[model samples]
Each structure stands twice: as structure tokens, then as C-alpha cells.
Target: MTDAAAGARTTAPILLGVVPFGLVAGVTAVEAGMSPVQAVAMSVVVFAGASQLAAIELVGDTAPVAVIVATALVINLRFVMYSASIAPYLRRLGAPARWVSAYVLTDQAYAVSLAEFRETAPGERSRLWYYLGSALSLWVTWQVATAVGAVAGAAVPAGLSLEFAVPLTFLALLVPAVEDRHTAAVAAVSGVVGVGAAVLPFDLGIVTAGAVGVAVGVALDLRTGAFPVTGDGEPMGDGGRERETDDAAGERGGERR
Candidate 1:
């Protein structure tokens, strides 16, 4: 198949996975006593699973609105990091594109896009397009699933363990994406810290664990100089292996090869 076809084929399963999870979130939100409209709106506007789940958890308990909003905000604080990381690429995009991109900026979109950017050649714009295609596929699926769930929320029986669906979905998505040792370490540490802090009130454990993981990653990057910087603001190179080229033949002969 052609590359575009291949990209579409590969992006299909990931988008499929987003559906059931989004449905579960929508169902749980309504089951938690949120109006169907409210639940659907949250999925449409917020779109962050963790934050939505946190808010739903609080809303279920009849917590104060302030508490629910605060917890949701805290759970979603990680998006700031995601935004910063992707800003360089999006800076050239016009205001309309920027707004749309920000609206669709979920964890999966950011992760998949960044991975594509790193793996593809700098000269190719198709990588970015592929990422956007995959993300938009997932985004559309989520909105549809959420709407379905909101309408069918009452039909989903109680005590069905649907709450675990979200985390399990995240696990399936993230486990395959840990391609490097540093990323693996960050995931492990973050998981441990997040679980350890689970007892903290108002979902503070998530924030704490996230902060620790970010610090660990940043420190590792600095120590290894994984991303090299030059005076001219170019990535000189570091950490990853250097390509070997034959001087006379002007051909490649990599140690890796």
C-alpha cells in the first residue's frame, strides 16, 4: 500500500480504542448525576479523560462545585507541559489552525504527534498531516461515543466495574509507546508515585506524581544533554547515535548498519 494508506490503516485501531473509553466516561458522568447535556459538553469541551473522571468522581459525591472544578483543573495541569512542548511546531500555524489544534489537544494526540515528528524527516510535512489525521479520527470517535453514552447512560448497569476502563485503556495506549529507557523510567516512576499519592485528598496525588515525573525527566535530559543546543539555536545533536558517512565515496556506512 502507499504510505498515506499505510498511515490511515495504522491509525485506525488507535482511533477505535478511543470510542469505548469515551463512552464509558460519558456514561459514568451521567450516572454520577450530571445532566446528559452537561456530560456531553464536558467531553466536547474538556476532552481530557483524567480531568473529566476527577470531576465526575467529585460530582457523584455531591461535592461543592468549586471542589469539582478545582480538582478537574488540577488533573488537567499536565496539558501546560504538552502545550509548551508542541508550541515550536504550531507557532507557524495561523490563528485558526492554532485554535483548532488547541481544542483537539488530548494526551493521545500530543503523544502520537510528537512521536511522528521525531521519527519522520524534518523536510517532510506528511508526518504532521498523518498525526493530525490520526488525532482527528480519534477526536471524532470520542465525540460520537460520548453522545451515545450520554443517551444510553441509564441502560448501563451499576457495579459493572466500568470505572477501571479508563485506566486500562491508558495502559494499553501507553505501554506500547515506551520506546526508550528514559521514557520507561519516567513511566515507572510516575506510576509508583501516582499510586503512592492516591490517598491524598482532592486527587493531589496525581499532580504530585506528575510533578515528580517531569522533574526526573528534565534532570535526566540535562545530565545527558539528550537535546544539544548551539549558539545559533540549532540542535547540534546528542544522546542518539551519530550517522557514519564515507568521506571519499560520499556514501553511508553506519556502525549501526
Candidate 2:
């Protein structure tokens, strides 16, 4: 199967999980007193569901704009890690393509695309197409679902427990990603720390837990020699592959000259 088609197919199940969250986000926005245009626009522009929900709740509480913005930023801080993890795979893309990629870098897209990238050969040209396929599918589904929720208003019943899908989807992705003792330890530490830190202000708990987990993982790696860092501060395994590719390309060019 083609990369894009494969990506779209892989993402289909998760799309079902996202629908209710999108619908809830739309309904919540209107119930929170935002105009229809504003609600839809937020979904289109921000495109981050958890942050949107947080921002809407803050707005409903009549929080200051600065507070709302800061809260949203903190809640979305995981995107920084996501961007860093995906950067090497996408570095060859031009500025505009990279920008588009960044814009559509949601949790589902990142999870599926990153798994695909790690398994696929490094030099394959279909990675970006696959990512785009997953992202576009998500984008369209979110917009349509949110629009429906906005129009339906509160008529969508709350007892449906639509929110469960979000965590369920993450859990599905997380299960396969935890491949070793160190990774399992990291996940355990991060989940516990995140929950323990949940009372922190400005939604800082998630970010703090992530930082602590990463630090523990890095220290473990250093002791085990699993992920030694090069002088350039890149992970030795993947970075070495990139450097070898560059050197080989340069040698071929010189020979031709």
C-alpha cells in the first residue's frame, strides 16, 4: 500500500476516538458563551483539543486573558517534546513544508507517524506523505465533528462519557511504545509524577512530570550506555546514521566532479 493510504488507514480507528472530544469541545465553547464563528475558528486555528478545553473553561470562569494564554501554553508544552522528537525525520523539508508539519503536529499524528518513521528505512521518501495523510485526516474529522457539536449545542448528552476516548487512544499508543525496562520505568515515573503534581498552578503538573521523567531516563541511559550523546549533543545512534549519509553523499559528489 502507498504511504499516504497506509497512514490514513492506520489513523482510522483513532479518528473514532477523537470524534467525541471534538464534539465536546464545540459544545463546550458555545455553552461557554463563544460565538459559533469563534468556536469553530478556535478549532481550526489552535487545533489542540486539550488546550482548547482548558482555555474555554478559563474563559467561562472569567479569567484574565494573560492567565488564559499562559495556561494554554503550559498545557500544550508537550508539543515542544513532540517537535524535537520528529525534527530529524523532517529536517530535509523546506521551510513552508516544515511549518505546515508543525501546525498539524497533534498527538495522534505524532504517535502514528513517529512509530512509522522508526520502523521504516531512514532514507525513505514516503514519511512526509504518510504524516500529511494522517494529519489531514485528523484535521478534517475534527473540524466536521466540532461543527456538528456547535450546531447541536447541549443536545449531545454528557452521560455518553465521550471524554474516555482521549485517554483510551493514548493508552493504546503508549502500550506499544514502551519497549524495554528503561522505557517502562520512565512511563511509570512520568505518570506518577504527573498525577502527584496535579495541584500545581497554571497547569504546570504535566510539564513538570515530563521534565522529571526525561531527566531520569537520560541518567539511566548514561549509566547503561544506551544513548550516548555525541559532541554535538545529538543521540549517537540516529545522529551517526545522519552523519554517515551526509559523508557518503559528499564523497559521491566529489567523485563526479
lDDT for 217 (candidate 2): 87
Using lDDT as the measure, which candidate wins? 2
Candidate 1 local lDDT, 1-257, one digit each (tens):
24334445556766656777777888888889988899988888888777887788888999999988888888778878777776654445667767777777777777766665555434234544555676677777888888888889979776665656667666766787798899899999999999999999877897788789988888889988765333333223321112211232344344335
Steric clash pairs (candidate 1): none
Candidate 2 lDDT over residue span 1-257, tens digit each = 37778889999989988898899898899999998788999999999988999999998899999999999999899999888877777766888888999999898999899887766544435778899889989999999988888888889888988778778878877888898899899999999998999999887997999788889988998899775434554334664557768878999999999
Residue 91 displacement in candidate 2 (angstroms): 1.4
Write down the RMSD of candidate 1 (Cα, Å). Answer: 5.5
Show where candidate 2 strays beyond 4 Å: 122-124, 228-257
RMSD of each: 5.5, 3.5
